[model samples]
Target: MRVIAAKEFSDRIRNRWVLAVAAVFAVFALAISYFGGAQQGAVGVQGMEVTIASLVSLVIYLIPLIALMLGFDAVVGERERGSLDLLLSMPLTRFELLLGKFLGLSAALAASTLAGFGLAGAMLVMQWPEGSLWHYAGFMLSALLMGMAFLSMAVAVSVVVADRARASGLAIALWFFFVLVYDLTLLGILVVSEGRLDLDFFPLLLLANPADVFRILNIFSLEEVKTLYGLATVIPEAYTSPWLLAGIMVLWMILPLSLAAWKFK
Candidate 1:
């Protein structure tokens, strides 16, 4: 598993895909960090709290898309190339192969996320006040977890689907559901009901979507960010604990990977 993971990681690095992703992340992070408050009529660098709130929106949209794209073809590509059978014919078990692939892809994702956001983080550290860095760190951590969750789902899709084309299509559909349609559907429900939906049950609905979980986790972590994102009025204080949301993100990663492992075996 270690050998496979190392080879896969090295291959992505050698192919320059990892570097390209990191560069993209760095550029976006910097732009959002510096210019996020322009809509609020603020000039110059925004506060760490406000910048983090802005980046959370960007992260929610971008990270999961990148993750799904990266992992959707992991297994199908191997199968298409006739390498999966050869790899399974070796000493490794199917579980080991899947595990190694996940680890490798995860490592690549993590490296890109850290390097790209780390550049922005470094700039924030230099310019922003010292106390709010932890909030930004929490945002980065949650972003990484969100990426891993989607990556796991993509891998599961690859394992269950017959070909890369189907997996690719499923990947896009998953992105649309989670990133776009899910929230819209929820909003539609709320609107159709004329705001009569119970606030208590609404959080459970938010918890169902990993993207919303990511948003709630970061938004509620800091009071300032919560206000900036206007989540203070909607999300209850009781449900905003960092540890609980983090656990849900973990479950999101585990459940999909478990399904993939079962199907692969």
Candidate 2:
């Protein structure tokens, strides 16, 4: 597993794909961090907490898309290139291969996220100088978790599909459903029901979507952030615990990977 992971990481790094991703992240992070408050007629830094809130929206959209693109071809691409047979003939378990791919891709995602967001975060620190950074730290951690979860889903799709074309299609469709359609569909239902739907189960529905989990984890983690995001009125206080949401995010990462492992075996 270690060897496979190292090879995968080295391959991505050598291709400069990781560097390209890091650059994309860094550019977006800097743009949003510095100008996120322009709509509010403010400029520059805009407090670490406010910057985190702005970046949460950006991360939710971008990270999952990047993760899916990264892992959608992890297995299928190898098979298409006629490398899977060569890989399987070696002295390694399917679990090791699958896990190695996951870990390697996850590490790449983590490195890009940290490097990109870390640079922006440093700028925020330099600009603010007196603000606490724990909230921003939490945002970065949650972003990583969200990326891993989507990457797991993508890898699972790659393993299940017989061809790279199908895997790629499935990956993009998953992104569309989870990141775009899910919330819109839910909102549509709520609107059609005219506020008559049960409120108790709404949180459960939100928790079911990993993107929503990321949003809730960051938005509700801090009271000030919550107010800035305007989720306090809709998201009940009972569902705001950071540890609880983090656990759900973990489950999101594990369950998809477990499915991928089973299919690979």
Candidate 3:
């Protein structure tokens, strides 16, 4: 299993598209820092925080793109290239094979995200920010878990679909829905309903969508800002707790991964 996992990881790392993704992320982070510094009138911790927030904000879009690119063809790509039968003929069980592929793709994403945050953190630390490195680190960890969830969803889509194009299309559409449209639609619903429904259930309802959980996580983590800056105005009362936000994210991470693995068998 370990060997298979290593091979899968290596295969993904070697892909040119993966390298391109790394470059894009690097560029995006640099741009964030440059613009943030310009706007803030100095290069310091606040600038760094802006950079981190920008990068994290980009995750809603980037994470799904990376996952779709990695897994849209996981099975179909192999099958189209006439490698699936050969792979199945190997001694590895379906579970091991799936795990190997998922771990590899996920590791690639994790490494890139962590590297981006690490570089940003070093810059922030050098600037002597009042914030702890631990806070940014926690945010990075959450981003990674969210990335894993996205990857699992992509893999499941790939496995169930027969055509690579269709699979990719489906993955991207789902990404748009969950990461972008779903939240907007939910807000519209709340507005149309005019708060007539219980506002109390919003947080629990939000758990059904991964992006909402992520946003809540970000908002709750910035407690001082929540209190002083009134940033909590956007957050529903039920999602005010970091623990609850974290739990919701965990559910989002686990449910899709489990369903994907089971469906693969």
Candidate 4:
């Protein structure tokens, strides 16, 4: 597993994928961090809270797509290239191979996210020279967790689907459903039901989508942001607990990859 994981990460390095992703992240994060408050008739690092508030949408939409694209072919691509059988002939269990692939891809994703956001964070520190670093750190950490959840889903898709084409399609479909459709669908249900639908279960429904969980994790933590989204009244304090939401994100990471391990055998 270590060898496979090392090889997978090495391949990402060899292909310059890590650098490319980090660059994308660094550029975007810096842009958002510096200009996040432009609409208020001013710009530049307004505060860690406002900066994180602006970047939340970017993390929710962009990271998942990148992770899915990176991992949608982990196994299928090996099979397509006629190397999967050779890999299996070696002294590795299916679970080991699946885990190695997931972990390796996960490491690459984590590194890029860290590198990108860390650069932006450092810049903010240099410019502002004050604020709780913990807030910015929390935002970066949540972004990593959310990225892993999507990457796990992509790995599962790669394992279950018959071909790379199908895997890619399914991955995109998952992204669209979770990132775009899920929240709207929930809102629609609330609208159509007109108080008939149990309002009590709404937060639980949001938990069903890792993206929403991620959004809540970042957004609700900010007093400056709470009233803007109006979710302050909606989500109970228990659900907004950072540790609980993070555990749910970890669960999101595990279940799909666990399913992939099961199916890979």
For candidate 3, write residues 114-164 as lDDT tens digits: 776666566655664666576677777777777777777887787888888
Of the two candidates 3 and 4, the one with more favorable lDDT, higher being better, is 4
Ranking 2 against 3 by lDDT, winner:
2
Whole-model lDDT, model 1: 0.87
Which parts of model 1 are misplaced by more than 4 Å?
40-42
Question: Number of clashing pairs, model 1?
Answer: 0
When sorted by TM-score, best at the front, the candidate numbers are 4, 1, 2, 3
Ranking by lDDT: 4, 1, 2, 3
Residues 1-265 of candidate 2 have per-residue lDDT tens digits of 9888888788888998888988887788788877888998977667767777778888888999999999999999999999999999999998889889999999988888888888777776777645446777788899999999999999899999999899989999999999999999988988999999887787788888989999998877666767766767777887778888888888988898899889888
lDDT against the true structure, each candidate: 0.87, 0.86, 0.70, 0.89
TM-score of predicted model 2?
0.95
User: What's the TM-score of every candidate structure?
Assistant: 0.95, 0.95, 0.86, 0.96
TM-score of 3: 0.86
Clashing pairs in 4: none
Query: If both were scored by lDDT, which would come out higher, candidate 2 or candidate 4?
Result: 4
Over 1-265, each residue of candidate 4 has an lDDT whose tens digit, in order, gives 9999899898998899999999998898889877877888887667777778888988899999999999999999999989999999999999999889989999999889999888878878665545547777888899999999999999999999999999999999999999999999988998999878778989999988889998999888788888899988888888899999999999998999999999988
* Candidate 2 lDDT trough over 10 residues, lowest sum: 124-133
Model 2 alpha-carbon miss at residue 117, Å: 0.7
